[model samples]
Target: IHVNISAEIIKCPQFVRALTIAIVIVCSKPNHSYEDFFDHVHVKLLTCYIRSEPLPEPEIQAREVQCLYGIQIMSAALEHPGGMVLRLFHKLYQDSVISKESFELWKKEDEFKAGFDEDLETKTMAVVVLISFFLSLA
Candidate 1:
């Protein structure tokens, strides 16, 4: 989990590589159940720092790939304890991390503003996925 958080929050390429390698390793272990692995491995998180300069194409592709991986694992992570799933969803939405149908629901809810503002991170791994793709081709 710390690794996931660090990869998302910290804009370092090294951390992204480490997190990607870690994710691939976790997914490769057939013995581990999705939920159990998620709980233990902590497959969660993202935060986008608005930047003036664009990232290199390779790095952008890498980020997009990471986000894709996060999207694949997100649903299962939500099934676990704590509000990780919802938190991730909100983070993703707030940061425009991913395009989700339910974002309309968030906009309709009165509590969304307060909740979104208070939370520092949005789990919009999907948004990252989308952003990465755009950046890669830029």
Candidate 2:
């Protein structure tokens, strides 16, 4: 019988590189919808990625990579053609997962605001990536 590996992968330690890869792979599958990214399972994962304590050298690196990968997944979801990028953006925005301060900066700062107002793809990625990096640092 086939099994859903994503659920199992979610249970893996946050420092496991495979966890990020598995999550992205599974969520990108045709059978899965963008909604899966906001599910409780992933919400918890995001919280862990943001709030978990730093680990030792190699593991810390792995954790950072995973956190970055998680952000990359969200960015990819937003950039995918024929996808609900706006819906995903709204979900992350409303849920406060995208960093309120950064989102505000995107709205407030002229340089950042212009890129965001123009709906530039790279700007979306940049904001989320930076916020995720900050989260990892915290």
Candidate 3:
């Protein structure tokens, strides 16, 4: 979830710090259940973003923020139980944050393969690893 903070945003140190704090809180591994942590983080993020002054294009900024949130959710899914993860994925898929077709391909890589293949596994694992690393940092 690499966010490209525009130059306009970068100039505002307070906003940047607030946004950074929000991101950190949202991505952090909580001492409590992930569900509770996620709920708290979600509410905090929405409140912070909503009350802030509008960006040049609020819709686009909102979409970028939503996409980042989706990635954070996906990271949580990977670290938790598979059932929990799949449920999150399903919800995001329905919301169109995650493409259903891409997920289906991820689900069917082995079955769809014409022959023995390492590439699919490698790619999938890489994504998992990268997300996990970021989540850890958060």
TM-score of each: 0.26, 0.41, 0.30
Best-to-worst ranking by lDDT = 2, 3, 1
Q: Looking at candidate 2, what is the lDDT of residue 17?
A: 34
Give per-residue CA lDDT, model 3, range 14-66, as digits (tens).
Answer: 34324534543455564534333334454445344433446454443443334
lDDT of candidate model 3 versus the reference: 0.41
Q: What are the per-residue Cα lDDT tens digits for candidate 1 across 40-121?
A: 2233432232121387655544454344334334333443323333444444444554344333322223321211232212
Evaluation by TM-score, superior candidate among 1 and 3:
3
Give the range where candidate 1 is weakest over 10 consecutive residues by summed lDDT.
112-121
* Tens digit of per-residue lDDT, candidate 2, span 1-138: 016455444434443334444555656665556665656676566556544555454443444434443444445544653333444445555565445444343333333111123344545555544554335434
**Residue 74 deviation, candidate 2, in Å?**
6.5
